[model samples]
Target: MGNDGQSVGDRRGGLAYYELEFADDGAVARDTGLRAAVTAGQVDDVFVFCHGWNNGADSARRLYTTMVDLLADGLARHTPDKGARTAVTGVFWPSLLFPEDDPTTGRPASAPRPTGGELAAGLEPAFPGNKDNLARIGVLLDDKGGSDRLAEFHERAKKLLTTPNLDAGEDSGERAAAELPTETVITYYSGWSRVDGQAAPGLADPVEGLWEGAREVLRTLSYYEMKNRAGQVGRGGLGPFLSTLATPDGCRPREHLLGHSFGARLVAYALSGLADGLVDGASPVKSLFLIQGAFSHFSFNDVLPFDPGRGGALSCYRNRVDGPLLSTFSAHDRAAGWWYPLASMLKRQDASSQADLLYRWGAMGADGYQVDTASRVRLAEEGFPYGFTTGGFYRLDANSVISTLQSPFSGAHSDICHPEVAWAAMAAADLAGEHQRPAR
Candidate 1:
């Protein structure tokens, strides 16, 4: 591509790749890749990465590169070799919604609006059928009205849909000219429809239904319930992403996942949404590294998705947090610790405080983050204390090189790709160890 503030590099045959493209002035772009070399017989462990909020492909790539570099480096330093080289895969979900303030890039970040819509619509056919299905439909309907003025879409789609009749014994120009062009109309449809002219209807009921549906598929503290929310696959991008990331050369082992604020909610959902393997059986998760997660707001019922009074439903019921996930790392950062939960008190009509509304979601007080003290106590009584993992390298020692120290406004959300945070993940992966080929 053009080198006007853009950089690109790839391995000889595209095995490893990296690219950096600027979306606007002063906004840096970074992209990197590590292709999987795992053959069916040679496959060892797989790591599929999912990134957090406000990140684009370039940023995700850079994060992944940093993760791979950190992994390779960490492995050499920490644990003993299991005589296997871990493969890494980077899962790039559409992140076009990342904010863009530059006058230069105009609507560059707005590019993914259409694709995001299409992805949402793909789930519409499954709506109201299953709780998860309905939630997806609702999410799709929620974003239906976004403006995308891409003019060339119709012509381009028409061209792609046309195919020649190759079996014809002789080529006929008139026949080709008379052929009707196949056209597929991709319309944007948000999950919400007017409630007698109102845009959002059944909001409370749908949300309640989602929660109830979710309880059927999850266990308290298990990964399944965490990933599903209000009966929908709440983690947004990654649920669809894993299917693409697990192909033969799709991903590697020990890839990194980073999320911020609501993004962290999605990550938690991804972790707990496993229905077939994770909730119903043993989870397929090998390791997870979470930072400044929004978990405190989530209840035990939210995480586990199941009533513990019912015994041993899912086989992967090990409660000790040793292997599958790393202990969550967090700081007393202000946004996560303070500001986020304080916004619930703001009146909806207060334009000045509009931005703060979401902060009240899981926060502390009335019309705010806090659940009532009585309810809090009740939730505690119903809490899954056995859910959390206590084992982990609690502190990043001097001997360790990964750093996640936050700046004044920095908290779990912005720490996703912070050099130190990335390094922390590297350290978590034990990437500094020896690598050996798997035995034949």
Candidate 2:
């Protein structure tokens, strides 16, 4: 609600402009020696941003520009001086992509590995109950390829959990398979920072060093901010950034967090860490805005050990047309045309694409043609306004988005920032009511 947009960063503890390319070992920022850099304003509000995979510093800058533009517009209507704050910080993690072979010059580096599509495929199976499929985890656990580590993991988990009681019936192969380790398994990415080929046998780290680095940075940043302020230090990203919300002249009093795709997964890890006391908890997050989430194994029916905190909040916005949880599906977006590829790998499901799964389910309605109707419905139901209900899933239409536009980041992944569509989706997610699944 604070004004002074233009003058916000000009004051003490002013906005810190940084462009850093993060790597497993550490990060390289445009402004070297942040320890020495000083701003004029007392930092008030903080917004910590996490970028998705395959993105460079420049791409993050562009995203920052879009967010700034939208924020400016929103501020013009509400705050007296156009709504500005003291500090805005961004964390840029490295996203290594396969080099591409250029057609024009026949350059080998121009030919990059199929990163986008791969990422989308990895994220698809996280959305269960799509296509009325009950538990789509079978796809990922299928291990049809015979040699994928994912398949092996599921197989092992199934064996450990479904061995039958001491006096139980014969060991039916069906029963062994049915006992998939969907529960009691937590995704572990430790030691992912080792060089790509160095990790060895089974596990290949996804988002490798990103999460670890984020944790270290958040801890360091928060400690630096609250050296003197009591009950202000934090460990998780959002919590640490919140510690910087006051004292700086241009700093505002409120903050917003926005995450997409694998970024959402990292956020979840941060939150989980906080709940488990692995991360410091001097301050807690106000809200979480998730976009195109790419988690594969989490289920709403199950109880998550996470704590909502005294003032924590959650909101999700998924694109019905998004191929996988990661990116678009069409030929134009060959790389991410399916639900986040990695999600599929992690969830251990098999679907040609997330869109195929949705089309098979009755959720899409007219939009079902090229849409992953079921996946979106699951995302909207379990994650959007809130978790899924017992009787049926929750459904949101265009109207729901309109109602929430006033406060959110104001955009949708499927629409790719199309103002009208983004606005509608936000409104739908913001609408209040227990929505039953619509008839197919």
For all candidates in order, the CA lDDT equals 0.31, 0.28
Q: What's the TM-score of each model vs. the native?
A: 0.40, 0.39
The TM-score that candidate 2 achieves is: 0.39
Candidate 1: tens digits of C-alpha lDDT, residues 334-400: 4444433332222222224533433213311111112122111111111112122222213222112
Which residues of candidate 1, in runs, are more than 4 Å off? 1-43, 79-84, 95-263, 279-281, 294-296, 299-324, 327-332, 345-413, 416-440
Residue 392 in candidate 2, Cα distance off native in Å? 18
lDDT of 2 by residue, 1-440 (tens): 12223322222222433322333222232222121222343333334445544324565566655554443343343332423342344445533221221112233433433242342233223212222221232333232232243434344323212112210111011221223342212222222222122342234433333232222222212211111111111123333333333433433333334444334434433343233222111223323333443222221112212222211111111211011121111222211222223112222332356454322211111121121222333222212333322112222232332232111111222223334322222222221232323222
Q: Which one wins on TM-score?
A: 1
Model 2: residues with Cα > 4 Å off, grouped in runs: 1-43, 80-82, 97-253, 273-284, 297-415, 420-440
After the best TM-score superposition of candidate 2, give how far the Cα of residue 296 lies from its true spot, in angstroms.
Answer: 3.2
